[model samples]
Target: MKTLQKITVILTIGLALSILVVFFTTSNAVSSGNETIIRFGHGAAESNERHLAVMKFKELVEEKSEGKMKVQVYPNEQLGSEAEMIESVTFNDLQMVAASAFSQYDQRISVFELPYLFDTYEQAWQVLDGEIGQEVAEPLLEDGLRVVAYFENGFRHVTSNKPIEEPEDLSGLKIRTPEFPLSISTFKAFGSNPTPMAFGELYMALQQGTVDAQENPIANTYASKFNEIQDYLSLTAHQYMPLPVAISEEFWRTLTSEEQEIIKSSASEAAQFHRDILRENEEEMISKLQDAGMTVIEPDRDKFREEADAVYEAYKNRFGEDFVNNILKAVK
Candidate 1:
C-alpha cells in the first residue's frame, strides 16, 4: 500500500513538470511568432537619397520594435516602376513606397508641381511639415495609402544638348518630362514641346536623340549620368519637387497604435536625414557634372517665373483661387 502511494506521488510530480515545460515553450513561441515584416519599394538606385531614406527607416524601425518588426527595401525598381509599386502598396502587396509621383493619385498634390512655388527650401518645408501637407495628403487615405512624411527632390534644373539662356531658347524643342500635368504645363508655358515619358526610358531617349532636353534635380542628373548625353545644365529652378513617404493603409490598419506611431516618427527622422545628405552633395554634384563637360548656366530665374504666370493662372482656375491661395499663404 505504501509503495502504491509513492508511485502515485511520483507520477503527479512528473505530470506537473511536464506541464511547466509545455507552458514555457508555448510562451516563448508566442513571443517570437508575433514578429511582423514590412516590404518597401522605390524606383531610385541604391545611391539615391530615396533609397538611403528607406535604409535608414529600416534600421530605426527594427531597433525601436526590438526585433518585433523587419523592413525589406527594394531599390532600382526591383519590385516595379513607381506607379506599379504604389498600386501594390495600395493593395497591400507592398508595405511602403517613396513616391515622387503621388500627384497622379490626387490632383490636389499637383499644387507641389506649380512652377516657382517656393522661394527657398526652408519655405517649402514650412508648408510641407505643417497643416498644408496634411491637407494635401488627406485624399490619399481614401485610396488605401497614407503619407508619413515629405521628402525633398530639391530644385529641378534643365539639361540639354543646347544652351538655354532664356525661356525662349526652349521654343519648339522636344523636351522630356515626367507624366505630371503641372510639369507639362510649366514646360509648355516656357515654349518647349513637352513629351511625358517614364524615368527609366529617359537615358535611352536622350542618347538616341528622341528628346532634346530633360529637367531634374542636380543629384538625379549627376547620378543618372545625363551629363554624358547632355551638353548644358540650365538652372531653371522651375519647380521644387516634393516626394512623399507613403504606406499601405490596409497594412496600417493591422498595426497597433504604438507600431503606427513608431513608423511615423521613424519616417520623419529618415526624411530629415535624406534632405541633409542631398543638400550637402548638391554643390559637389554640380561640380561633377561640369567636370564631365557639361556647361552649367544659371538662367535668369525671374524671367522664367514671369513666363510661367499663365500656368499659375490656370491652376487657380482649375483648383479654385481659394485652394491656390491656401498653399501660397502657408509659405509665409
Candidate 2:
C-alpha cells in the first residue's frame, strides 16, 4: 500500500508541475478569446542591436495590448531578404519588416542616401523626425507600406584589402555595392567599378575574390565577421542608412485606432532604444575589430565628401533640381 501511495504522490506532483509550466509559458500571452498575430521580420542577427530593439517592441506590444496583439519576431532573414520580406508585407504574407532599402518602394527616398547628407547624427535625426521624414514615408504609404519609425544602420564605412585614404585610393577597385542605383552611382563617382551584389552573397564573394572589397557600418561589418577577410576598415562615413520599421497597410487597416497607436508608439520607443544602444557600443565595436587584426584607417573624409558632390549632382538631374535643393535646405 505504501509503494502504491508513493507512486500516486509522484504522479500528483508531476501533474501539478505540468500545470504550472503551461501557465508560466503562456503567462505573457494575451488572455483574450480573439487575438491578433503580427509577424515582424528583419535581416539582422539575434546579437545585433536591431534584433534587441525588435524584441523590446515585442515585449511592449504584448504588455500594452494585454495579449490582444501577439508579435512574432523573426531575425536573420527567417522570412526573407529585406526586399522579399517587404514584398510579402505588401501582399499580406508578412505583417512587418525592418528594412534599410525602402528606397526600392519609392525612388525618391534614395535622395536621403546621398553621401554626407547630414554632417552628424543629431542633424540627421532632426531632419528625419521632422517634415522630411513624412515626405520620405508618404510615398511608401501610397505603395502599401506604413513606416512607424526610422531605425539606424549607422554611418557606412569602407572595408577593403588595401588602405583607402582618398577617392583615388578606391580607383580601379571593384567594390560590392547594394543593387540600389544611387549606391552604384555614388561608388561610380568615387572611381570604383561598383558591382551590384546582395548582402548575403558578400562574404563568399570576398573570400573567393569575386569582389575586392565592400562597405558597411562598423557594427554590421563586425557582426557579419567581414573583419576576418578584410584588411582595412577605412572610416568613410559615406552614407547614413536608416532601417524603416514598416507594416503592411492592409494589416494596419484591420487594426483599431487604439491598437494602431499602441503599435506605433511601441515602434517609436524601440527605435529610440536601438539608437541609444548603437551610440553606446560603437567605440567597443571598433576596438573589437582592431583586436581581431583588421587595421582601422581614418581617411580624409573631406576628400570623400568632395567626391560625393558628383553623386548629388547626379541626383539633381535624376530627381528635379528644385526637389533636391529643398532637401538640401531642410537639413540646413
Candidate whose lDDT is highest: 1
Highest TM-score: give the candidate number.
1
Can you give the TM-score per candidate against the true fold?
0.88, 0.88
Q: Write the per-residue lDDT of candidate 1 for residues 116-155, one digit (tens) a residue.
A: 9998888888888889999989999999989999877888
lDDT of each: 0.88, 0.87
Where does candidate 1 stray beyond 4 Å?
Answer: 1-32
Residue-pair clashes, model 1:
0
Error of 1 at 128 (Å): 0.6
Task: Give, for candidate 2, the lowest lDDT window spanning 10 residues.
Answer: 24-33
TM accuracy, model 2: 0.88
TM-score for predicted model 1 compared with the true structure: 0.88
